[model samples]
Target: MSAATAAAPRPAPASGRQARRGGHPLAGTYPLLRFALRRDRVRLPVWIGALTLTTVGTLSSFTTQYPDAADRRAAAGTMDSPAGLAMTGPGHYLDDYGHGAMMGHQMLGFVLVMVGLMSVLTVTRHTRTEEETGRAELVRAAAVGRHAQLTAALCAAALANAALGLLLAVGLGASGAEGVTWGGSLLYGAAHTAVGLVFAAVAGITAQVSQFSRGASGMALAAIGAAYALRAAGDVGNATLSWLSPIGWAQRTYVYVDDRWWPLLPALALAAAATAAAYRLSTGRDVGAGLRATRPGRPAASRALTQPLGFAVRLHRGTATGFGAGLLLLGVMYGSILGDAAEMVEDIPELRDALREIGGASVTESFASTVMIVLAVVAAVYVVMAALRPQSEETSGRAEPLLATGLSRTRWAGTHLAVAMAGGTALLALSGLGFGAAGAAATGDGGLFLDLLLAPLAYAPALWVTVGVTAVLFGWLPRATAAAWALPVYAFVVGYLGTVLGFPDWTGDLSPFGYVPRLPAEEMRWTPVVALTALAAALVAFGLAGFRRRDLDTK
Candidate 1:
């Protein structure tokens, strides 16, 4: 053939592996697995290490705090209540180091949540998100198989969970407490790993069914939340109900008490079933398409949706509604238990002392205040997420189109910021109402409604600080905005372990919540709240200025 008319480069025979791999599926999964690991190298290590450190710190504290037989028995007394059981796990003998095995009792629920979030986000990010961004199609255009992406996501989750399990085992076993045993540590680790895998599978299934990656993530997280709620309700009321939750299954392992390993079987079964379902579902759908179809919207936009601020509200309404509903339920659940708080304090001197140190006045006040504080902390997450919406919009190229028009960058970003701040504040207020209403109804004390409603407001400034911090990161360091999440995560850690781990008061003070009045227990302080509000406003102003100066990245 002449050089100019050379035979076109021959296409590989679309036969054998190339043709059959699509049918077989999972062919390119190994390479995808490597890609997942590389992407998650830092995130996985941070999550595993943080949880392991918490485990070590908690175990070490128990050894020091309950060294004597009498101390152990006294400590065990606090664990007997329905609320305690709901928060921790089934009761266990506290004497002779059995307590060490149940060290996870204080932290495991949160750890499960963390790991579950990790798994759900991982699967959704790799699958639906890739498809949403058109990256999956590009990858599939290569030698990739049909199911490689989903398989890699699940495998990555499994690997991360397994690594987390090993870390927990080593950390717990090395605590050097007289009650700590290697066998219990191993079982404990295995149970947590199993819990993560179960949620990973749940994520995979949701990813297959939900059209939007966001919807997939939401569904998976909702399932996890529902599981936790079921476990809590069951542990506190009916033991049989607990059987329905994967978290309950893990708790039933009784690692330190009986060292049972059977719970792993059910979790493994669930993981296998879910993964199989996902794979089967994958083959039925087209690339980038989901089992569920997006509902049609109005033919014309509403008058309110025409403006930037209205547009922000329209975008934020679903998220706001979700947060409000979840928090309201949570508040009601916590409030329903306040009647027992006083009795609990009377029965357990250790708990009373701890509450007093943290600013609990009466047991009821102390308990209610603590619960409200926790709700406040959770509310901050909504604020941070909302504040970061502009960043998401910008990166996704949605904001670029708006900014390219007459809309100024400040006006566009400000709209989302308003939603984050105002919506978050409103959610907290709703939470307080839910809590107060439920508590009053339960106790037949109508006076409680006012107290509960006003109490959450005390923490609003702290929540605003989180919103400000996230906005600051989004504006000044768009690429590094993810680091903003660490603030709330760290706040949760400090709030949970500060007193238990004997961290310096100043260390806890790093959390904005640390500055908020403990409310109901202590009289509300205005100075700190005002200072926090001023600081938050300043930060937001500074961030907006920075954002205006920077060029938008359309790519």
Candidate 2:
């Protein structure tokens, strides 16, 4: 008929033994979107609450934390260095030194990165993950269209991003902060939405290209990390490099200061373009398969695969490898800045005093202690993700076949937990060494390397406690494996901010990580470490008992 109709997707052909499901390529998209939302109702709310509260708390605290123009201007000096620029955004905002500029320049980078992460996981969880677990095949066997699943996933991500953006806009506009306005706040929220949508589209393409769900997420996440680096370098050295990254696009918007809206257009256009490409690519692949076909396995099974631990390792190796490398590099980045740590806050005594209470230590060492929380919390994330993986296996139906052969549930599940434990420890060790080596080089002190390297190991018991919590959830409340993430998130907020902002001591005592002695800055204490280790062992033992008693989720 018309040009528009010609471009539209057609219904299935009415022929063959199987009757055609007569609808467009997006036939079941709305229903699928509703189902996805239903499944993530609790999860989505938690994400929204965390993001909104963090934004509000940080923005509100800025006024009280830096009450005068002199303080804000002095504070801007901390973000002037290359290391500072790499962590924050462009130096343009530093010129104004207002509360809104401070929030936008500092808050946007971290907020967008997190929003991107949430979007990537949401899409991968619904699309490739569902396909890998065979639920996509089952869903497709009904009246659903080929493009319906991916469409629903992207829609769900969009909804979450929209909600986050709305909350941020409302918070900033109504905050009564000196420089924040409704127009600027609206632009701020739009920037977040634009970045998130772009990442969700990136995840859609990655989901189609990767044969496995983890690979899909890893690819998208690597893209996010690369964007951050590119933007940082561009802001510091080359303006042109920023053009290559979506994050740079969002940052250039300069919300509440320049309040530029033109930069967001690129992000929105890229999101639309990538989504179209993902849909086009999906037409060439079958359900449960990817644009990248799975490689043929060796005809014979490896000796390691015959054992439970090896099988578990093989399943986890891809995710662990990617995440571990990222953590190590993050540690290096944090450590490389140690030489400049004192310079950043030299004019602000309040900021410096909160870093640590160590006697006879330079601010540099205290800075290391404050940042160690971020590194340890990141490692704990891996612990939680890997530890709860057994629940994924059980729900996917793969574990049942193995269990039927000769493996008991406890042995099979324990193998997975062992892998998680070893993998988490290895990740922490690599990060520690990276931090130590980088810090030593930056400061030109050989002695610091050994001390810093040994310091992180002290957190291993705290990490084991994280693994134990996940094990407890997987054992008794298998459906509540997602709850394991609560501890790490809480620990990050309390440990990082409380130490920096001089929060109450009991606030630090609430998390398992709170029990960890601030190494190098504080003398190593064995009492808390031993208690945490014992608690972890007890939790793991109790969890194993629960897992043994509970029925597996075959459906």
lDDT of each: 0.81, 0.87
Model 2 ranges with Cα > 4 A deviation: 1-21, 358-360
- Please report the candidate that would top TM-score against the real structure: 2
Question: Model 2, poorest ten-residue lDDT window?
Answer: 15-24
Question: Model 2 over residues 397-438: C-alpha lDDT tens digits?
Answer: 888888888788889888888888888888878888989999
Best by lDDT: 2
**TM-scores, each model vs. reference:** 0.91, 0.94
Where does model 1 exceed 4 Å of error? Answer: 1-24, 74-78, 91-97, 104-106, 343-351, 438-446
Can you write out model 1's per-residue Cα lDDT over 1-555, one digit (the tens) per residue?
Answer: 689988888877777756787656777889899998998888788878887887788777666656666656655675677766776766643333345645756566657877898888888888998887777999998878888999999999889899999999998877777767899889889988999999999999999898888789889999998888888888788888878989888877767777789977998999899989999999888888899998888999899998999999988887788889888988887777676666545644545666777775466777787787678877888888889889878776778888989999889998888788899889889999989988887667899899998898888887778878887888889877878778777876777556555577887688888888877888878999999999889888878888999988785
Lowest-sum lDDT 10-residue window in model 1: 92-101
> Global lDDT for candidate 1?
0.81
- Model 1 TM-score is 0.91
